[model samples]
Target: MRILVTGVTGRLGQLVARRLLESGHELIGIDRRPWDDAPAGIEMHSVDLRKRAAEDVFRKSHPQVVVHMATVTHLIERSEERYRINLGGTRVVFENARACGAEHVIFVGRHTYYGAAADSPLYHKEEEPPMAMTAFPELADLVAADLYACTALWRYPELCTTVLRMVYTLGPTGQGTLATFIRGPHVPTVLGFDPLFHFMHEEDVAAAICLSIERRIRGVYNVSGPQPVPLSVLIRATGRTQVPLPELLFRAALGRFGLPRLPPGALTHIKFPIVVDSAAFRAATGFQHQIDEAGAMGEYRDAFPAL
Candidate 1:
């Protein structure tokens, strides 16, 4: 099969492209900017999807499966920019896939689209309703528009589309709250309690995308690790000493810095457990994580020896 991946430079997309190549598929990788560092032999298109004719570029490649991993990420705070690129880029990708007669479309979605509350549920099935966007105003702005674009693709049954609502995908290349916590000056464990978090290894996420492409499964599926680990356990695995920050002191310091105090919603998230039910995806495919939590941490540690 010939596969084309957008966001080929992102951590997840790059890994997926590598796995697809290993599985004997030819790849056409596209990103807004060229990656001189991308693995050799990947046929790359350096055009910006927002400004250029994305459909024409894709038509020339004529890939069988279109794995759409590109998005305006969370750290990009400008909502208007996110709306233009994340939401707009997805619409363009899906429409282009249909026009180009691609067999399938696989999307990487966020679990936060479910809700950030830790006690919300152990796992969210694909059939469950998305967290009320009105209430989660902040996250809603980033994910809701993209979710709509996802639903639009499903209306065409001829296009086999799968939305992989993924958890905090982490490995060495990951950055964000989890990465900050992992590469902390000292490991900080929850003093009172910890929320349940599930992580997908970069390689496993890549493998899941390949599995979906090969199997041609359509529908939303949860992509996550088999085991759900507590934040305390993750801190210990990093071989760093834990400094228990009292909730009061933590809030006070954040306040002094003029940072928003951890809202009850965010705090509850770290104290309770939330798991991703990956059984459906696992049952459909034989692949599982090549690295567990400890192994993943070891890999991250090795990648940055100073840490």
Candidate 2:
């Protein structure tokens, strides 16, 4: 299948594009600018999605599936930029995909839709309603925009549309919380025991995406790995001693120095246990996480020596 990957310049996008290629798919990778070094045997297109003419690029490629990974993914800082890039960019993709007559579009969403509470039941199905918006106003907006992006497909059921609500993915860039601790100025930890959290390796995330495109499954599905790992276990896995600090105290101390507070839903995230259920996705494609929590931690440590 000929696949078009937007945001091919990003870490996740690049990995997904690479995985698809490894699986013998033709790819047309589009980014705002050229990659530092283009991948072998793949076509690259430099087209700014913000520009109206960019739609023609997709139209010309005429891919069978579009793995829409491009977005302003960061939840903290750059609110205006995130809104413009994610909200605007996603809308543009949906409109362009439909116009180009692409057969399938898969959106990569986050698990924030589950809210911050740690005990919150892991979301496995779209039938499991999103938590009512409460705290995390900024995140609420981001999540809302993501949901809005998904809704565009509702208008075009004839098109195979899917939304993959992915959880914290751990990999090379070391952006996720687990990665942060492994290569941290200091490992940040919450007091009164840690909460359960879910993660998937970057490779698996890319694979699941490739599989979804290959199978052309439609509708929303929560994508995550096996059992959620506890925070303490994560710390041990990293071979780092976490400095136990009360959440309120830590935030207050950081606030005193005028450091930006964690994003709206973040505190709720560490306090609550979240396990995204991907059984439906597994059933559809027989996908399983290649790296579990401990294995993922080991990978991060090896990639960036644990202090």
Candidate 3:
């Protein structure tokens, strides 16, 4: 199959691109960032997803499968730019997919859209509406992007649209929200709160995406791996010292003492857990994680030693 992948320069995107290439699929990549070392045989295009040049890639390649993983996930960027890239980029991807006559369109999303709260269910189902807009306003654009991709299912009945709300990924790159939070010597935690953290190895995440494409699964599904563990256990496994602080102090201490700067809304995530049920995805694609929780944490720790 001919596959066109957006954000092919990102860590997860690279993994998925390589996986597809090994499986004998012709790949076309689009990303604003330059992939100087991109493996041979991939037709690379450097362009923002929202721009007109991105549509030209679709018209020329005419890929049968489209994997959208180009949304911004970090908070460092200005909110306006983030919204334009995340939401606007996604809208354009779906529009192009439909216009170019793509068969399958998969939107890779995060499970954190469910929002962590004291009242949140232990395991979130795909049918539940996203609550991050209120609990974590920083993620509003991501939620909107996911919702927009989901709408394509009904809006364009001919397209096979799959919205995958995947769990946090831990791997050698140390490039995800969990990695950033635990980067410093001391990992911060809200006092009296030990929320469960759901995560999987980066390789497993790539395999899940490949499975979704191969099976042509449609609709929304939560993609996860292994069992969930407490936040404290994760910190310990990564060789970081856990620092418990009062909610008030936790907010104040961010961006100080070698910690990464985070928005005020992120505290809710540190205090509560957002776990999702992946039975739907498993049933659809028979996807199982290749690396266990301990292996994933060990690989990350080995890659980035404790400071």
Give the count of colliding residue pairs in each prediction: 2, 5, 0
Best by TM-score: 3
Go through the candidates in order and give each one's C-alpha lDDT. Answer: 0.69, 0.73, 0.93
TM-score of every candidate relative to the true structure: 0.86, 0.90, 0.99
Models, CA RMSD each: 3.2, 2.6, 0.8
Give the better candidate number (2 or 3) by lDDT: 3
**Model 2 clashing-pair count:** 5
Residue-wise lDDT of candidate 2 within 1-307, one digit each (tens)? 8888988888888888888888899988888868878778688888788786678788888888888877665555546777777778888888888888888998888776766654456444566656625656566555765687678667877678988888778866676544543355345566885777788788887888888987888888888875778877776776666666787776665433333345535566656665777778788778888887777777776776655
Q: Is candidate 1 or candidate 3 better by lDDT?
A: 3
Give per-residue CA lDDT, model 3, range 1-307, as digits (tens).
Answer: 9999999999999999999999999999999999999999799999988888999999989999999999899865447989999999999999999889999999999999999999999999999988987978899999999999999999999999999999999999998888888888888899999999999999999999999999999899999999999999999998989999999988898999887789988888999999999999999999989899999999999998888
Q: In model 3, which regions exceed 4 Å deviation?
A: none
Residue 70 of model 3, lDDT score:
95
